[model samples]
Target: MALPEDMLHFVWKYRLYCTQGLHTDSGKSVVVLETGIHNHDAGPDFVAARIRIDGTEWVGNVEIHVNSSDWNKHGHQYDRAYNNVVLHVVYEHDGVITRQDGTVPETLELKSLIPVHVLSRYEELMRGLHWIPCERLIRTVPTLNRSQWLSRLLIERFEHRVTAIFDLLTRQRGNWEETCYIWLARSFGFKVNAQAFEQLARSLPQVVLGKYKGRAMAIEALFFGQAGMLENVVFNDTYPRELQREYRYLRKLHGLSPMDVSAWKYMRTRPGNFPTLRIAQFAALCLRSTRLFSAIIDTEAVNALKNWFEDLPIASYWYEHYRFDGVARPHSVQLGKRSIDMLLINTIAGILFAYGKYIGNETYIYRAITLLENLKAEDNAIIRRFSALGVQAGQAAESQALLQMKTYYCDKRKCLDCGMGLQLIKKQ
Candidate 1:
């Protein structure tokens, strides 16, 4: 009997097929080493691997399937990438296949050996419900194992974020620090103002900011200039007007054109998080700290770095207003404790990966792992939902999965590919 589709993933995940020795349709013995379900973005669906084939030990990358016909279904015969596939292992036997090189690839069928209970359990997990799928089963899984799983998942999560960083670095011609600075500033603006901040960074340029380093006025000019907020508006408030004048002079000095303030949107934002205030807050940090990136890099103590960020606040003017002309508010636009903690985690993790790649500093890698473990998990809406499902996210791994679900699967509407979806389908 054909295995249920819900259990297919479990079978694939655990590589359960190899318990039976590898045998081709002709009954010739084929020595098996390992097998992996293809997980690449653009490739064949599965790989049946072996230690050796025809006297060549460690023959790599064999394609596999549930039946011989799926090879044609997935259109692998025409794709050259599948040419390296040495053996074809299927669950059902029916066809003869030849590679472009004229070597007839060996095929094996695996229909009888897989356990039924495994499939049933997977089906149970995948069943849809009024609330969360596998709600009861998640609680039965050991917390320690869950934590380890999350740790691995969180590292993978960071790698996903790093891919974007790599793209930014490439755009900046491989200046890691500059790219880091721009990304930090963009993140500070959050999703609402990210594009504006990016435009600001591109307009003013980090090199210009370096020239005005340690001076809040120069920093503000660069920020406002790039934001396109320092146009010909005549404001009576001495600070706003003075900054505009300063930006005008600086724009001329740098031979730069004026930016369109229309590009810097502030609709629907709370005054506290308005782009103007956030930019000013970033400018203040740039002025207050020289060697900011270096300080983060050299700090062995996570608490010390956390304390530094906690103590810093926005400029006095920003403490009173969310916009250029908003009524004064009592609170300062400083980074929150939770936000600071996130920054520390991300920065430390990023530096750890960089140090590992550049200087072979495994210590930084270990430190990054330790810091993530010590920190409390972020409590966001998605995490809260997972908690309602009885999958409490108290550590990095669960949080990572939650984040991955939110960013990738949920946003992309690819629920079919998600573990949660698989669990729900199995439950049914």
Candidate 2:
């Protein structure tokens, strides 16, 4: 395994070098004045650093490496971005380097500067087979730091979701309603056939559904027909024939094409999660609300929206059968409470977060935060694993943070970059 350069960057960034005699490879008198701002984007590791070299102050960027030869290995010698680097900081000075303009900057090696304990802790973390390397040490981190890290993790997850929504919004020409429709349709698929459901939405845009708004039959016809459901089944019930006829007329009138019905997953699926019922339940929501997505985004108080999705009435035909010719289940097809929560967490929260971020409005973000905080924490494998290690998630917000932490940090074994890893390894 390669030694991560981030460790060297960290050491260089915090001025962890031995201060008794700090000088460049060229043997110049050097004194640290100020370390530059750490830059995450393109260009340098740190910018605007002020350093006194040979009793003269110089200001520019700072680059870091595990070995001086990495400077050439990374082609920084030819890159113009390195021209402004005032210093080349490395762990070992194996080779010499110069700027693109044929000038040499000062070099400081951390081979004698870095402490032993940090390296020991880092190696220990890399050897772990535990759920997380810091699982045993997580509880010792101060409550305030842990809380702040979790908050930051949750925001990271939220921002990731927002970026995805913005990509869809851009493809849809900034149409929020269509993006919401596509998002909700995918959520309704519940992760199994989400792609198929999204294709269904794109095949029949929300504007098509808008033309048939408040007309339950027309909505059903368009939704089912575009789903490739109405054309294949022969039903004894009057509703199917009516839908078939209506869809045939509208399909030709609007030049509509239905998706392949085989795209939906059915084997081993629960009765409640049948695609027919989900589509009907979603269509019912469309019929009930004049503008479903808009109504959700415009709401101010979280209380009014708590039970908003509970009582959606699926079409009567859905109650009798899960498929077109399948035997009746003898039970009503109504949306479940968990399904409502799924919508809130996946669709509503995602859309509101995106809208807030896109326009720089904090109100929608606040509403999204409140809604998630009110809900119970998710009970998946990741959450259960974190819970087993004595980290309790009291709300969806914390659960989201745990997921981000586990996926992004623990799995990657970037303990060197984590707060827990820092506190656990720091010499006291």
Candidate 3:
């Protein structure tokens, strides 16, 4: 019978030792340097580590798991990285694992030594809850310690995001400014219309806008034209006519083809979140700030950047019109404090990772992590759902892990490979 996974995680996480002598299936005595879950890129779930095989004590990492079969389940048996694995530890020994070089890796099974109470508590924690997981224990968890833990988790989370951004950078040939612009443009869609925004950016090159960067009218025309928002629009208004003229001038200046405005989608969005409004707001920010990317990178005072972002408002004409043909309604284009914070966090992470890659400064990477930890956890529906399950948002390592789970695993449905899920079944 399969044990509950959470219990397994708690046992692995806490490293509960069993009374049985640690030994490989070949009958060689194994000395364990660590009994906790082994960190592997891909392999068995866990490894029973040994310091020495025969008279020679091994001095490297080991992998572990709940079953010997997991080695094949995760395809570690065929991977060369597992060749250095000193010993394979599992909850049950059902099969053997061999390294790529044809050496049969030593194995150990750990079915005993874990206490029932520990598993019980872990299970209870995983079950449904009213307020916070371990609400009774929350007040007792030291504030300073909790804060430090949270900081660590937040930095880890930020590093995770930066890794993805770096991959995108690699794909884009390390054009940091262009990549940033793409991200900024995509983010403006606010989850509801990301693909559409990305399409708009791809259809209209940032190079075109760069040419007219000094003039706000020229910039606005470039934005509106590329967005396909200017098709068949006849307006007597001063701002509309001016934009129309500017668009025509830019098309002629760049020898650009007309965009397919019909490709844009606006079915599910409110007027405030329409692509046109977002693009206009983006244009306004670009107009007001000439050296936006440099300003972000060199900014020493976080508050200054916060102030600058907060002050940015959408163009005056956008406040009334979601589209050129739609009835006008008043709306402001200013970035919220939360939005600014996210941008700062992402920008800092990207710059730090980039700098680290260029200069070999691990300190920059650590500092980037520190900045993320200092901020509050991201607010979103998934986080709120977790929060409702007694997993209150706070400064704990677990909370940080929860946040990461919400952001990465839950959103992506990678639960089968998650640490949390592994822990959930360890006890049974």
Candidate 4:
């Protein structure tokens, strides 16, 4: 099998090849000092690398490739970014490379230096057809290393969420509360109707809902009306009929239009998880607090947050109805414990971390992690698969890390970038 250039990068990055008796392709003796920092941006592969060639010290950037000709093949020969390259490293030195400045940098080839076992292990992982690339070999990695990697992946997941939250905040004109409202509303839809709920929130801004403050019926009217659920539909129940009337008045007053009712999903969905019930539950959540973001920031205890969602005063009409046209057997309309935990995990924790980053407060970040630690691990296909492989997640934090690792690393075949894969590929 042909090796990817990334394998060469991995080998160089981790010093997997023999470092003794190194030399350039031109026969000049080479000595490694600092490998420098790996650059992920648009620049050299590695920056500020320090090395000595023929007893002379040089410090600059370093570029890696699978073949020496890749330099010219990638047009780096004409790009000024390669002009300051102090060394050119390749797995196979197939051709001579010249910089744009007409200078030939020293080149080092790793074909004869890298361990055969390392290549074998990498090939094995690359050929893996298991749940994860290194699933068969993951048990070889120490538990401590796996835990440490999970911790790192958890932070990575938080950072990824923070990036999204910050982008939303930018669009919301730095209004944290509005962003929180939009995100929380989306979370209410879970995975099935998240986009539709987000559109509803965007169509009817939080300020529109805020005016209704203490009035439950008005808030539900705004939420259900803006969702387009009340449009062109006759409700047999008095509550929805009243909501329809209330929404008509509010709609004209605010000059607001409703989203397409088709935006919501119902097929294969549980009656309890219906969008109508979620909308009603969200209205109740709104009634519990005037400001969503402030509530997230002020609430300290995990149980308190859970209780806040659990104790929401969902209207009696919703207790016996899942939709406007139909009534189901009476059931608790308030969000269940698992549902509340999911909300905390996806909505509250991410915003808390993002807010902490925005305000440079470590307390909120710590609090976010603490909240996840207190929640049960999410039961999902991904978590179950990892458990079958003996990689159990005891809390939401670890489950979230597993989710991130699966989506970003396992599914993408980024084994070279994963700590567990690295451990499995590197010989002891």
| Top-scoring candidate (TM-score) | 4
Question: Which stretch of 10 consecutive residues in model 4 shows the poorest summed lDDT?
Answer: 1-10
lDDT of 1 by residue, 7-115 (tens): 3434654555546566678776666666655555566445545545545665556665766777777878788887877777676767887666666777766666555
Poorest 10 consecutive residues of model 2 by lDDT?
Answer: 300-309
- The lDDT values for all models are 0.66, 0.81, 0.63, 0.89
Count clashing residue pairs in model 3.
Answer: 27
Top lDDT model: 4
lDDT of 4 by residue, 37-74 (tens): 99989878999999999999999999998889989888
lDDT of 1: 0.66
Q: Counting only residues 3 or more apart in sequence or on different chains, how many pairs clash (N, Cα, C under 3 Å) in candidate 2?
A: 0
Query: Per-residue lDDT for 1-428 in model 3, tens only?
Result: 34544345445555665644666778887665555354544543445444666667775556666788877887776787778777676677898767778888777666655667555644454444623334333344444554454455555675676777677677668866666666666676677766667677665666666766668888888778777666578876777778888888788878866567775668877766777777777787777664555655665454765665666545677667777755686766666667666665555545655556556878666555555555566676656766665456642234555676555654554433444433343434
Query: Mind giving the per-residue lDDT tens digits that candidate 2 earns over 35-66?
Result: 89988888889999998888899999889888
